[model samples]
Target: MPTSQAIQVDNLSKRYGKDVQALAQVSFEVGRGELFGLIGPDGAGKTTLIRILATLLLADEGQATVNGWEVRKNYRKIRSHIGYMPGRFSLYQDLSVEENLRFFATIFGSTIEENYELIRDIYVQLEPFRERKAGKLSGGMKQKLALCCALIHKPVVLLLDEPTTGVDPVSRQEFWEMLQRLKEKDIAILVSTPYMDEASLCDRVALIQKGRLLSIDQPGKIVSAFDKPLLAIRTNDMYRLIHDLRAFEPGHSAFPFGEYVHLSLRQPIWPEAIHAYLAGKEHTGIEIKPAQATIEDAFMELMTREVM
Candidate 1:
């Protein structure tokens, strides 16, 4: 049985101007304390969706609720209870780190001292530079400060929109670790990210595109659902390899992945034939191996299926 919902939406839709539909009848429910991720690429309406849920933007159609407070009716109450960290760093660049934290705490009629422990772990990283202007801080420092400000009031839900975008790899890892600690405290977290690797960090993820929900499942379950045997093929000449593989009939799908090409032979029986053909082409260090499909692969397959 499903647990109580921390957030719920029904047939949500949004549009800008006349032709651009930002969202299209999207609906999903997130359970209490669950780290739910909304995964998609740019222009996938992730920001718009988060804005709506945060009570910062009105939806064109449908309704939603956070912590049992109706979004449309009790937006004021909802806003007070939800912490939102936008994709862009929107903190006061001229303000010192400590000043920024104090301001956000004051907005919620709370004090940093009252809820200090809630943000203490994250704020300690920023404490050394507490007197420094936000603009002068590095990407990672800014990220930590932003998070501290957002959590200063101990909101029931944390909504982070692509919070790991430009930070260093070490910082990204640290940020995720902090999230793990937050989740342990039973705070519901909804994070949106364009990166696929981050999807596995969440308890469950909703693969979204064009403002529509594609699939919602545990990371491992979603990956297990991937049907085709994926192949990671590498060669000395990747450019020529891609051209040749695409030229093969049955219209195989291939995309550049790191140093290799992720190729899915359109037809099952053609793997051997394709391998032999590639070897005949005098490709050096030719390696073809069955590979696991990642969240990105599942997302691509879902998008392709949607398009078809």
Candidate 2:
């Protein structure tokens, strides 16, 4: 482990029974004070990796260090130096919001007031509901309390596993803003999210699927690496457009994207050729134009490549 890295994982692999490989030789590093995102969909092993680093679970074969301490050899030390917020809200439902914070702080041999400066921004918002039961709080308020508890000890590293999975969009945005502020204090943060749009917010992201690492780099770099030109196509018949485009001779891939279908070509061809092909198929209102490659596009491309 380097001094600059807050967390380091090497060839970490974990399996459930004999068939389900939750993480397959997954390796990456989170630099100090950097916000690193583990981007993936459901059951993609994002949580597994986070748990390993958090010292909550062990890897079947591989090594991981948090805050310069080996996970297995120094579980206590790692746990003390890092904050972990699991995907699900894991707090005492009966305890008041302030009580939950106090409990976590006491567990770490500290008091909320001792580290009030570190969590002031979040705690202030939670002050109004300090006496409210944790279980009775709204989704956003619960999220805030969980984060405050995680930061009660003022850990150097933070591991958040899909913290915004079921949160409202506004809360999600606010949470990320809080994370940005946390980074200003030089606290390394490793966050996982299923949303591709959130990937861009991280300094760097590792795209994972089915327990395997697909790609790791800055969001912009990954998008820039998409070699093929992309086009957004839409027609009167949205459902048939996708199948028809995939059936086209020059089409390499066609997938529905919201109101339009994103099509990739095996080789560059004139737009007129695409227009003519669709027109021949009795497709009308055919609109095709160049589109920029996005993080979602890059993830889909990597998934397609992995399958092929």
Candidate 3:
């Protein structure tokens, strides 16, 4: 392991029973104070990988280290040095907001007054509702309380699994902003999210699918690696347009995006050629334009190649 890296994973593998492989030779490194993202959809092994590093679950093969401590042999030290927030709300819902904070602090052999500054920003927001039970708090409030508890111990590393899954847009934005402040304190942060748009927020991201890593790089680099000329097409009849686009022998792939269908061509060709082809098919209200590749586009392209 390198001295600068806060987390290191090498050829990590995990399986359920004999057939289900949750992770396959997944390897990555995160430097101190770096914000890293594991971007993938559900069932993509994001949780499995995070759990392994948190020392809650063990990997069947390979090795991993967090803050220079082996996950398997030094779990006690790792647990004390890292703050983990599972995908679901696992705090004491029956306890009041203040009580919950006090409980976690006590378990760590510390007190809220001792480390008040660490969670001041977040805890202040929950002060008014200090006496309110955690179970009665709304989604966003619960999220904040959970984060404050995680930070109470002043852990060197933070592991958040799908932290914003059920949050609203405004709350989600606020959550990311909070993460930015945390990163400034030089704590290595590893987070996972199924939302494609969230990939850009990380310094670097590892794109995973079906237990395998497809690509790992800066979000912009991943988009630039999309080598094909792509176009966005919109028609009056979306269903028919997709059917015809897929049947076009010269086309490589076609998938429906928000308001248009993204078409990837087998070879770079003039727009006039595509217009003529669509016009010949008697499609009405046709619109076509060049499309820039996004993280979602890159993931789709990588998935297609994997299938092929």
How well does each candidate superpose onto the true structure, as a TM-score? 0.95, 0.97, 0.96
Candidate 1 local distance difference test against the native: 0.88
TM-score of 3: 0.96
How much does candidate 1 score in TM-score?
Answer: 0.95
Off by over 4 Å in 1: 1-3, 270-272
What range of 10 consecutive residues in model 3 has the weakest lDDT sum? 1-10
Model 3, position 179, has a per-residue lDDT of 87
For each candidate in turn, give its C-alpha RMSD to the true structure in angstroms: 1.9, 1.2, 1.4
Question: Scored by CA lDDT, what does every candidate get?
Answer: 0.88, 0.93, 0.92
The lDDT, on a scale of 0 to 1, for candidate 2 is: 0.93
Candidate 1's clash total is 0
Pitting candidate 1 against candidate 3, the one with the higher lDDT is: 3
- Number of the predicted model whose lDDT against the real structure is largest: 2
Give per-residue lDDT, candidate 3, residue 214.
95
Give per-residue CA lDDT, model 2, range 157-204, as digits (tens): 999999998889999999999999999999999999999999999999
Which candidate order results from sorting by TM-score in descending order?
2, 3, 1
* C-alpha lDDT (0 to 100) for residue 204 of candidate 2: 96
